[model samples]
Target: MRLFRPSRRAASLSVVLAATLLATAACSGDDAAGGSGDDVVEVNFGYIPDFNGTSLLAVAQDQGLWEKHGVEVEATSFTNGPLQIQALGTGDLDFGYIGPGAFWLPASGQAKIVAMNTLGQADRVVAQPGIDSIEDLEGKKVAIPEGTSGDMILTLALQDAGMTKDDVEIVPMEPAAIVAALSSGKVDGAGFWYPALATVKKQVPDLVELAENGDFEDTVAFPTAFVAGNDVVADDEEKVDRVLAALRDAIAYRADHMDETIELTAEFNDLPVADVRADAENVQVLDLEEIDGYTQDGTFDTWLSGMQDYFVQSGQLPEAVEPSEFYTGDLFLGAGE
Candidate 1:
């Protein structure tokens, strides 16, 4: 069985390099608690297996790039973005990779999005072959992580097909459980990201891809980004900078060395290399420039507004909270500049 390992060397290096970067940027001061050469800053980051951004994190750790930059990054796996955001708010985590929906909690004054990490077309809602059409999902069981980007997309697809959530039995489950649920005939459809989607399709050759972001016009923003607590960012600006810089390099490496990145990601996730390669076709690796545009847009703001509206209509949140409160593009833009 493939197990996950967090890189101690990378994490330690990230902290140290972060301090140096901040000092070089002329942003360091006594109030900033400037660390001596011996202080080891620890940054805990959360990631999900299926997200393409995780590959970058895995590479950064395995390669010790973060260490070269003087920062320490500990990457942990979370079941989903919501849980990851929850951890960020409670200070159990320093940073994490999450979908656009993560802005909701942060907008509610819980956390903040430090940087828009990666943007790409990766998520897909797949159904059994015979059920090619979304309408066919009626009376069928569909599995998705509740309140996730996938779930929202699934809902939109259903609505577009003149159907509603009531038309199908929605089951809440993690990506790992999705394949089994479909293979066992317990679920007629599932909304998931690449590697997991590839695994499910491999087992169920007749799987149908119902919908993806690329299929929808005027909806190009899928802000899957790295977020940190406000306290974390304020307490260690240098560390945050180093983390972003390392990730920026990792992203570059991913774009330049697709095969190697895919192989490592496949190994990290314990999936076949061919499966990872196939999934790579849909993965969008964002550079610093692209990430800047994504965060500036009202894309995340608009999405949060839509989600808040949905929550209010569904009785999820008390009412629509302010979107600006949840997200701040300062750190993301600052890092790129």
Candidate 2:
């Protein structure tokens, strides 16, 4: 049996559904979280319902951290960021936990990033063992999901090797399909996120980890973050701050209780605890105090700006936008305060 959920990997979260969700968000009013009183703010939050940074939101819910911060977090499950950001833009959602699409949605004026949830450390480039380095893969076939952290990191790794996408044969495939293609040696290499990446490694132990975002820490910054509606920052900055404060509490709690964090997230995601723990080990979960260091330093800026350039180069985006066009750094800087 496969270790990961195929539903999460499937393209059920297509852009067409993003439009439909945006059009009918007003009718889907089922509540998911909150407190009894009216004074307590009700935040209808959206997230992918699986392991990964979604676990942090699970922590906040299980620990009652949202209530502690004078807000009620109503959780909604959206399979992808585009749909969530569309709902956010229409004022149906207060916030979303998302991946690389965080930058693109914001570039289009749909979302504003208030806090980062985790780094994009789980995506990796794996190849046949003999192909030792990224440079060795030039002129070879590599499969990946277009417009994801995996593709972005692979592109960066190749560029760092003094080559470009033009140097390789790019075959677009879904995560599970990439796993099969790479394992059978039908493709020279592939890029994937955890569980899928982990799956392929277990199935073929000799696969070379050609390069990942971690390899280019000096030049790349890929993060998954808590994105707010652009309108929320403009209209209800107070509520947005409250959500940030609650997330700060969750971040601190996660740092101190890794074992328990793993257990809870696995249960919340309905997966084996061991699977969730393995995935957890692959990420750098940021804490409240560390937030400033990431934002005040150039790392955060480099990540968002770099991702924009990657999107444009990949043709996922038409052109690059000023950081201000897609991001609100001030909101993230002041999230904990």
* Candidate whose TM-score is highest: 1
User: Model 1's lDDT to the true fold?
Assistant: 0.71
- Count of backbone collisions in candidate 1: 19
Give the clash count for model 2.
Answer: 0
lDDT per residue (tens digit) for residues 1-337 in model 1: 9997659998889889998898776534322333334544678988877536578886787776666555677778887788987887789999888775444566566677666665557777788878888888898989998767677667667767888889998999977788788877789897666666766766788788889867753543556767788788778777787677677777768777778888888787777788777777776677655665655866656755766665555444677876666666665566523
- List model 2 lDDT by residue over 1-337, tens digit each: 7695546435566656887987566333322223334547888998875565577788887898876666877788875566777798788998887777346767656678787777667778888879988888888999987656677778777777888888889998866688898778899987667766667777788888877667877755777888888778889977887788778788889888888888888877788888888887777877766766767775677777777777777677787767765566676667546
TM-score of 2: 0.75
> Which candidate comes out best when scored by lDDT?
2
Q: What is the lDDT of residue 42 in candidate 2?
A: 81
Candidate 2: what lDDT?
0.75
